[model samples]
Target: MADNLLELDTPVIAILRAPTAARFAEVTAVLQESGITAVEFTLTSEGALDALRDCADFAYPIGVGTVRTAEDANRAVDAGAAYLITPVVSDEVIHEGYRLSIPVISGAFTPTEIHRAWVAGSTMIKVFPASLGGPDYLRALRAPLPDIPLVPTGGVTHDAAKAYLDAGATALGIGSPLIGDACTGGDLNALRDRALALREELK
Candidate 1:
């Protein structure tokens, strides 16, 4: 089920791609306070590894994103990532992640790629830029490849998460809409409130 893929009780996954370490921490605190149990720091973000280490003590599941190589996967593991998420499927990264006993979510856009990632030992197949296809895309993909666990990422909104779940996605990966831009001036209270609202909505 969906619960098996996350290894956590909650279905939400917060993507923290802030431009600075301070902003990353700020966003992470807000997400935790909001009751989200899963968080990911994209490698494209500055100080992402340090930020991951900073929040290692939180009760939620912490993970890293945009991982492309074995070295990146190892770095993320060393930084205390409970899981690894890649923007694209990489055998090297997936193999390294498995070696470290860290669950890997490999990004795949097509049924072929999804099946490939699943066969490669990926914990879940992330459908990147999922907005383009929306829930309908997942619904269509599920008909023939119902066995693959899919997590729709990129452009997923708080209001749209449940639809993806209903459409057969294992879970949802929320980014900018949830975390907002680091320079846009984030409001911890607002983020927390939104997160809480999202959790409630999911239920």
Candidate 2:
């Protein structure tokens, strides 16, 4: 795989933010069983990069999230992260993704912020805290910037996943909603079930 996240027909990035690296494998397995191909292991976890490397052999895109600096971006690229995801728009990090030819999903909410992230070379613009505005917010943003690949991440749930997509989201960046407390309780089956439901809903 060339590790391009944008190539997927159903672009759903399963944001896995577990407390322990031990659970990463199980969660990843469940997601894969449910046909989830794009995943992001947040940097907050102690062994996120290690988890990413371990899953590098999987036939899907695994990326690093919550990236705030160019150094972290560079490190993630070196660690074999297929893409980079950020909660905020950072010029340095976005530029680094461009230089590395790794897709970057930089987060922003407002028109100005979204546009800035796009111009900074982010492969996709993530609308962080999107729940605050809901799918309607994305609809408004799309009015003017119809070409930007807006990814509405954070606070997105399966019940509302289709609406966001209908509102113009290129993809959905889902976290706890899909993984749930499975990471904490080690419920791989629960995560798998949710992933299946989500996949069906998106259809």
lDDT of each model, Cα atoms only? Answer: 0.83, 0.86
Q: What are the per-residue Cα lDDT tens digits for candidate 2 across 1-203? A: 23356555566888888766657767887798788878888989878888878887776667899999999999898888888999998999988988988889998999999999998888899999999999999999999999999889989988899999999998899999888887677577778788888888788
Residues 36-78, candidate 1, lDDT per residue (tens digit)?
Answer: 7788888988888987788767766588999999999999889
lDDT (0-100) at residue 164 of candidate 2?
97
Q: What is the C-alpha RMSD of each candidate to the true structure, in Å?
A: 2.1, 1.6
What TM-score does candidate 2 reach? 0.95
lDDT over C-alpha atoms for residue 175 of model 2: 91
Q: Given candidate 2, what's the lDDT at residue 41?
A: 88
